[model samples]
Target chain A: MLRREMNAPRDNIVEIRDLHFSRGARKIFDGLNVDIKRGQVTAIMGPSGTGKTTLLRLITRQLRPDHGTIVVDGVDIANLNKAELYKLRKRFGMLFQNGALLTDLSVFENVAFPLREHTNLSNRLIRHVVLTKLHAVGLRGAADMMPGELSGGMARRVALARAMATDPDILIYDEPFVGLDPISMGVIVRLVRRMNDALGISSILVSHDVDEISTVSDCSYLLSDGKVAASGSPDELNRASSELVRQFMHGMADGPVAFHFAAPDYAEQLLGRDSE
Target chain B: MPRELWITFVEFVRTFGALTLFLVELLIQVPRVFVRRFRLIVAQVYNAGSLSLVIIMVCGAFVGGVLALQGYANLTRFNAEDAVGIFAGFALIKELGPVITALLFAGRAGTALASEIGLMKATDQLSAMEMMAVDPIRRVVLPRFLGGVIAMPLLTAVFSMIGLLGAHMVGVMLLSIDVGAFWQQMQSTLDLRDVSEGILKSVVFGVIASLLAVWEGYNAIPTAEGVSRATTRTVVLTAIAVLITDFMITAWFLR
Candidate 1:
């Protein structure tokens, strides 16, 4: 019986402060902070390997930060115990990059899983609810299909149905629009907008596809070098003067992110000037 | 040298600690699984036990036949052909039944469990369960563990029964030994202690094999190659562990 507070001030559902995380010798996030506003689609845009997925994992408490607190639903997740962390996660649903459907189950059963596990619904009721969820994503006809039998877009839609099966208050989409045809991409965009508004749920979309993000996202954050390089509406982002933001938004080949790996100067190396 | 030793010691402690925690968590979830998801446990029993019956029966018959042949050959030279039943019965009930059943179970069901769970982890199904407020250990591992424990004794009993039948067939029908003497000797020589000991061994082997399989799968690297490696490790480690546990149980029983 989770209900969204639609009229509530668009306060932050998730907030990070002075976050620091590293892998081996490389630092990914340093003193990073971001806020996911309630009841809105917040698109996180970044170049490849800029900790966008890591940010989602951090919010879900799947990965811990080396420093700083991730406050989800007003509770500091870093301080929550195992039982508390799981309770916190129940409020959030995530659509993984690869769909991540349970391959052993059919489309119907995949969406029915969370309901069966968490609720006391009868089989008849479960079936009814599963069909309703699948219908939300225009996949009611595909309910009996197996994950492998579906196309990538179909699988993504089924995954979306499964993610929203429990009617979570927050939905996190990691590369939801990747690897889809134009029609499929459009369907997903419309569904994201429709579902967010219809269910009155907050959403966080992490994608590199700027056109789609600009079309669907209410507000967007461009992450660069472990911080928010730019934050604005899609129009504002497109019009921003930051070269890094512009390079990313325009999908330029040469900019802040080099086109080639660093190496010795070509002429000097070819001439073998110093032999050192 | 000191640093190397220190690192090794630290690694040992860490691994031991993790394993202890995993077992504790598994044990804690066992009752919850039985109470809430008894149907899952039943399904696993069918998967881990009933699916394994044909192989265990086939192996049991062959092993018994071979033992009868070898025992008859050796004992006939000493004019002790009548002792074939005693030899085969003792061997099957006391040792071969449990040990061979365990080895076969490890190769078949243990590897399958590992790969299945590993694939689930690789596909993020376990994480999905976690996000839905369900403990994967309770939903996935506990039933499998209990299923293995329950299946081991039943499979071992089947192996023993089939082996005894094979021995009787070989010793009485093929070898022209007296059927009455064969049955009578086996019945008298096989004690309750012997049967119970085999059951205990199979149960312990079941725990070791299933726990190791689930642990490997749960901790696998979540990749194709990682799942493959976890399956291989399940078989190899379960086999070695079964053998070691058999030795310890036997030594204790004998002492």
Candidate 2:
């Protein structure tokens, strides 16, 4: 979440240049360039199926782009091997869309996963760290419960706790507000800000909720047509000159963006035939 | 024709590279994966192994009853009903224990692993793991594999022993085959190879089931439909692999 520093700002932590990715024959991202600075929340927003998640995958090195480079913390993520990539990923934390907590594990184990995987901390220390993360996310009491027992909001918070368990340098949130109620959304958004401020972690939030994104992100980028079409502060996007960006931000239907529910002449032909 | 062949070869190489990369990733992070989820592994062992106990026992006992019934009827016709205990014990230890149990476990745990991981992949849990720097194969696949490998031999041994006991119960109390005679026949015919073959088959089946489940789960694509497909494939492939291994082991050992 966005947390402004009163003095000086940290340097950029993530940089991508001319990134292109293809899944089979489908081109998902092409010639995409962006920079995610440290100690700030950058929201990437787009419609569904516009490859918002794919872009995140590329940044995280889960899916390598067909062309171009992604550098995080002065290292090219693309050039790293599996082992090196695993090490690099230790710097990253992610809150998935569905709060992907392992169904078989308790909430305590879920939060402790990253710590146990990457560190040699004693069980006592691991417990302390896990409970601290849980407490940060306001779920310290639910540590022993199974994922299935938790509500949707609780599960997402557990996932957030697990994401931060290892004290990652970078945090990525994929649609944190998608399925939550207003209260839950408020809790998560607040926790994101609180955790970022408390831990000073860099974050990239991918969301479609413009209002929430506006409230939480210092900078926002609109991804469309396999590229970042517009990017700036929320005010910049709200008053952007680009027609497409304006249509998207204001949610206007009578713009260049079409629904494509029918072919150009299908509706007209159907109506004419019915009249005849 | 040459161009097509070249394309096919390149595709094969790419697939091989992906698999090799996955294996290398798994190998590197193995310790972390196991250490982190040791509790889950223990829980899975209890869930999978304990829940399957009654079925294993029932099948073993029922199979033993049938073996005794059939062996008594056939061998008595030739005035060699004394061989009933020997044949039943040898068959149970050599073939039924490993093969039947593997088939059962594949249907139970193998399918479950495939579907569970597949669903996780479908829902982006695998991606979540990646972002968290958690190794899915080591954390998820390896533990389930270990469970099957560890549980299979124990379950099979239990099955074989119980089956033999069931045979003995019927053979002595009802069939009137002398208990002393039965023990003598088994002592004379039973060898370590017979018992070892079943354990060996179980190990192979365990490896195959785990590999299949992990492979399918790793390659799972979008949609819960893909997970369903992986579950079916895991069961069928594991069962078939178990049968093939059983035949190979039986032939090598029996001969």
Candidate 3:
């Protein structure tokens, strides 16, 4: 990944306003607004099924919002046509929850993919760039191996390398720590911070792992009811007033997000004692 | 009007519209894939063409043998045993080559294309590519589609050639048919029209099979069961389409 000038402090790299999205009849984001500052790690945390990944999709223009606007680097993404949107997307690198390395390609080819597609770098230079990226993720030795031959954590690291291959202006990680060992989780968290600082790029990390977010992110937002319930540093969120934030931060099972699926009274249903 | 029925109708229309649009996009990208991504296309050609060679060859040869046996028996009863070679050649060239090759392609290459792309969608590899500013349609779908299209006709040619050779072997060696009449009668009887009809059918089937494979895949729901369903749909739809197109083409060509 190429190094770039650090973004101006306190300037926002991404901004959303009055965002609304729905799946069929269910609304996911209603009048939601959030901002990601330039050259910083911003963690978007929420409960399961709260549309953390959906928000990332909306930002990346993978899924358009039903209404409202998303501005990336001050360009209204909603208005961009496919070609313009693709041009805008060149600035973003996303890591999916499952790593999502190309199964048919070797680890080196996977990392080299974006570069080869987007750049005309010669063979020798492509190899150097690929190796540099793989080296950054500590998987240079495993470059020739197929993705299937790599472990879950190794796959994630290679995906990280691929994500960083083109030196994007912004990096988006959608549940990067979802299915990793604790050591892997620690490595990813450290990489998120280090890559952001070293490359001077903003990163949007969508994760619910409180500890990892706390360790990695410069700013954190806890979402509840399609809006930010709390926004601050980890310590600030821990001492926040919102019940939902407290439950999320502490991993409490039952709070604003219910533990049940809104069914009829359980005992009554089982006994058939309640009239329709 | 029941709600379920209404929903199904709407879903059908939506899928139809999507497929039509996808067909147009594939048409546009097929030529582009040929121009820039020659290596990718070649790799997929090896996958769909070279990998399916054995099954296509074995089935074609067996079919030819069966055809020769049946033709010899029937022709001998009529005291026109020399027509057996002509019979096998006409049947193989006009119908079996294109139809069976397509069915086999559906089973072999078609299923592979659908499942591979479906898995890629489910795993978010396509989305990752989009985020990397690469069009998955151009980079992934088109190469595979082009390969399948290129492979379909070549496989048909291979199947026909091998099938004819098998018929010749069985006709001369097993049935005691005259070697000269076996080949010479068939060659004289089979004209350009017959060969062109076969190639035309293969070309149409190629487009349909390749297009549907990638269509079902690129639009697959991103889940295990979704991918399985898409793969199944690719085979079923391609089979039905191949049959329908074959009948239509034969009727038109004969007319």
Q: Which stretches of candidate 1 lie over 4 Å from their true place?
A: A1-10, A261-276, B1-13
- For all the predictions, what are the DockQ values? 0.64, 0.66, 0.80
lDDT of 1 at B213: 83
Off by over 4 Å in 2: A1-10, A122-125, A261-264, A268-276, B1-44
User: How many steric clashes does model 2 contain?
Assistant: 0
Model 1 chain B is weakest, by summed lDDT over 10 consecutive residues, at B125-134
Residue range A1-276, candidate 1, lDDT tens digits: 234564445489889999999888888998888988889999999998899999998888888999999888777898889888888888888898878788878999999988988789999999998999898788999988899999888888898999998899999999999888888788889989988999899999999999999999999999988888999899999999989988999989978877667788889989997477
How do the residues A158-276 of candidate 3 rate in per-residue lDDT, one tens digit apiece? 99999898899999998898778887777778888999999999999998889888888989988877777789888899899878888889988888889788798999998987775
lDDT, ranked from best to worst: 3, 1, 2
* lDDT of model 3, residue B65: 90
Interface RMSD of 1: 1.3
TM-score of each: 0.94, 0.87, 0.94
The complex in candidate 2 yields a DockQ of 0.66
Per-model fnat list = 0.64, 0.82, 0.88
Q: If the candidates were sorted by their DockQ against the true structure, best first, what order would they fall in?
A: 3, 2, 1
Candidates 1 and 2: which is better by lDDT?
A: 1
